[model samples]
Target: MGLSAVPSGPGGEASRTDPAPPRDVAGRGAEAARLADLVARSSRGHEDAFSELYDLTASRMYGLVLRILRSADHAAEVTQEVFVEVWRQSARYAPDKGSVLAWMSTIAHRRAVDRVRSVSSEVARDEQYAVTTVVREADHVWEDVEQKMDVERVRKGMASLTAIQREAIGLAYFGGYTQTQVASLLKLPLGTVKTRIRDGLIGLRDALGVEE
Candidate 1:
């Protein structure tokens, strides 16, 4: 490895060599071919191929999911979900559209986003559940059906907001936390948390067709 000079900054980061630069494109093509083959075999129910594929990519995919999720347990769970989907849907991969790693990472990122959305929706559903619990006089059958419908609506509506907005609003409104508390929990500025909550609620309202 050789060092390369970079501009000095407050952190004073130093020069770094880009590894495998000489064969970067060729290496990627070869790697893509290898992974595509593995995916194809895995799709055909080859246990060995799937095992090798996991060995080659699981760490990278887990790291990517962890960064997005910021929770070890959630990240681990979603990482498994991503891999399971990959094995199930491997036949759907099209190299013409992108490289193998690109396809895998896309699945990982989407799964991570879904996990975030699910958490927020679960919070909203919990609130609705509490309401249903308090209103015990209602017909049990209709109440259960209505509760399910409401939770489904929240799931659909929450998807429209950005992940951060959904999370902030969930904490404040559904999780029963104040805006200040949400800010503290998310480690964001109070105004930013407030704005996310506002924007998120507006989006949800529009999705649910709430007037005013």
Candidate 2:
């Protein structure tokens, strides 16, 4: 299970303490075993082991967070937080439950989800406060008529989009999901999702007679 480099020989070449295994055979299970060892060593207060663990997992962890949050800044912050938690809770890791990657991914995913909910809650509260504090005045009849017409135009424009384009746009813009998340939710390729959204917006713009 050791993933460390082989010791050097007298001539400074890697010593063959054991025969090399086929990469195709050793790739998947070997990585899992190495990660498990890293976690175990980290739990024993080995900084080097923890550093190796972070190097191995940080990219994947950050990618997962970015996919959920759709913000590089937030993803970087959350990735750092995830490693801190992993270092603090390393001793509590139970390898029987799952692989190290799975456990770490779970922590990263939960942290990202909590951040999304917290931001959403704060935004909602701020919006409610703004609505309550704003002065309400009766609009002129002409103003009301203009607003109604604009609403109808938007509704009709939305209706003009194809079903797939509408669904992608709805999930990305209104439901507040990233394009990658929309692709996963719809079981479509990411490029396909992007195309749908782009096409949908163009259709809406054309229908609304919007310039540029």
Candidate 3:
């Protein structure tokens, strides 16, 4: 429902103010391999491996959901749903497609986004019905139209970003991750992630016709 920072720890646990130490490429690869193996085992009905997978990833998944939903209770429930999907779909995971963490993050992002859109759709329906029941002032009607146009403009602007830039911005803004976390997830350097976000925002501002 809103964007909020959720402090994350090394293993993606939330509520830790300390920044996680950076990992070398080899270290990241090792972690990815570990997660992938766990997934594979879990898919084969290894209960202990599934439990370990939950332990390793739940905190980070919860943080991501919390950032998008801005509600701890909803986040917790969604996090549980995410892992259930993970368990059910673990066999479908392909190491060739991406890291296990990335796979799980995608699932989390989609589930959270779906929840937000569901709520938004319900609100929009109620508003539409209400509109037929009450007459609005001309100016208020114009304001509503303008707001809808602005939202459309913003969506178009986002479509203008380069794939990498769009992805970085999505993780940082919509996915509720810090630049550092984005870099970690993307396996890019911190500075590179910062540049992408900066350039992406500039592009979006220009698209919106906003002056510096």
Per-residue CA lDDT of model 3 for 1-212, tens digit only, reads 43345454344643334432222334445767889999999999999999999988886687677667665556677899999999999999998887788799999988876775575532332333233324323434655454456556777889999988999998876765667879999999999999999999999878766421
**Which ten contiguous residues of candidate 1 have the minimum total lDDT?**
13-22
Backbone clashes counted, model 3: 0
Where is model 3 more than 4 Å wrong at Cα? Answer: 1-22, 120-212
lDDT of each: 0.71, 0.74, 0.75
Flag regions of model 1 displaced more than 4 Å: 1-23, 120-212
**What are the clash counts of all predictions, listed in order?**
0, 0, 0
Supply the global lDDT for candidate 1: 0.71
Ten residues in sequence with the least summed lDDT for candidate 2: 131-140
| TM-score of each candidate structure, all chains considered together | 0.47, 0.48, 0.51
Best by TM-score: 3
The most accurate candidate by lDDT is 3
Pick the winner on lDDT between candidates 2 and 3: 3
